[model samples]
Target: MNKKTDLRVLRTNQSIRKAFYELIQEKGYEAITIQDIADRAMINRNTFYLHYQDKPDLLDRCVEELLEEIKNAIVQCPISMRPFSISTLETVMQTILEHISHNTSYYQAMLVGENKIYLFQSKMEKIIKDKLNEGWTSSQGKSTLKISKELLLEYLVSAFMGVIIWWIKNDLPLPVEEVSSQFSKIVAYGHFKAAGIAVEE
Candidate 1:
């Protein structure tokens, strides 16, 4: 497509997405309808359907974009940084923080509503799994289910999600860097144990 055509499509999709997001913030996902999104976007139901198959499809696309942004951030991260290091964790935190910051109202609504929580958590889980896979390669006989690497990564991801939820609920009192540094230390200890780099005294 030509640049103008591409821009128009992007602009239309963004408008529809924004309307849905606003509806979600106001009455939540369960109450939101295609008509509501179309009304808010000043577009007809046909336009909404043209851009997205359904509400869930739109949400899935939104989360996919977020995940892609996260992957890109990690890929662009400095190679000198150690995995699960404080610096590395900050990079992760920065991505989350930026997203939350950018969509504070939307996230706040999601946090307050019961329906969106599962979707948010699942998205976070996928991001963690992707990042863990990026950081570790599997060896022969080392199935992800039975390996310490996977176990530790799962634990760390769970912890990170918990902290993120808490931070968002609490209005993010501390700096993201400070909170993530502490999380990194906790995760680093786990990584050390998993990788046989440290022995318990």
Candidate 2:
């Protein structure tokens, strides 16, 4: 039946992707081949070809699929970004962290080690930057910002990415809410305030 055929196709695609991700972590992306993927997936090279044109195609799809999920989640967050509220940062980050928790292995393979795919990291940062950029407006009526929008955005995105990598690299030490809250606090206040260090008045 056509239904059964579609189900089979779905299962096979899952297998292929799972194999590709595992191999990325174990062997590094540059070292993996279609045959390696097929063997790890327990499928033949022909099956891999049926789903993807080549290894590059498979890698592209894997990155695209994950990034698309992130984009979708970001789009769903209704928080405003201008002025950089703690609640806004927490909400958006919580959404992303929750989503990442569901697929830690894929992220680990793409982001955690020497084997990490820089392309995935770059694309993911771009997604975050684009989302953050969407919330900023020129401070026409408000007080002028001491920092440039570009610089602030860069800091937020880099720090966000660093925390995420640290979270995964350390096996997610803190719960999502706690991590987001801490990150939000540090951003809204200074690190000294977030850490309870008394500032010299």
Candidate 3:
């Protein structure tokens, strides 16, 4: 009976989440209401309130959960093995791409359309920035950087998000490996493309 109860709760949560994502994709966040979610999830308003304080709370929790997964994926990138290596960056990007592939709807709802949540983007960038900075602190050779660490990292994160959004909007036109590899190349060899400057590997 306890197991059945737990399974029911889990199922309800999944239903609510699925309904929320579908609604966000269909009508945008601002227009959604408690009744809308409950209707879509086939649950009562009281049930919705039992799980979340309100729509904002639901959005917060959903974003938090998804971002936590992204943080975990970043942690799995083996930054310690080669903190600033192109391969490490590629691995991290590919990991993120693969993870997003598993939850495309959530990302699409939060990031891809006119009604997308900018707050999600802002929060995600901060997480990525924090992780990259953490990696930089643990690694060496930062003394050789010609630009401020903050500026360089900000640039990298912006470009990183740009590539991701582009991929998501395009319905993932390129394979994850190829996109990650090209991204790394752009990061490591962008100056080469802009000018004749050769970047040492």
Candidate 2 lDDT by residue in tens digits, 1-201: 999999999999999999888999898998998889999899999988999998888889899999999999889776665455778889889999999999999999999999999999999999998877767652234535688878998999999999999999999999999999999999989899899999997
Which parts of model 2 are misplaced by more than 4 Å? 81-83, 138-143
> Candidate 1, which segments miss by more than 4 Å at Cα?
1-8, 78-84, 105-112, 133-148, 186-201
* lDDT of model 3, residue 125: 90
Full-model lDDT for every candidate: 0.69, 0.90, 0.87
Worst lDDT run of 10 residues, candidate 1, spans 77-86
Query: Any residue pairs clashing in model 3, and if so which?
Result: none
Give the C-alpha miss distance for residue 31 in model 1, angstroms: 2.5
Q: How well does each candidate superpose onto the true structure, as a TM-score?
A: 0.69, 0.94, 0.89
Worst-scoring 10-residue span by lDDT in model 3 = 76-85
Q: Between which residue pairs do clashes occur in model 2? A: none
Winner on TM-score between 1 and 2 is 2
lDDT of 1 by residue, 85-150 (tens): 556666776667766766666566555455454676677677766665555552233343554766
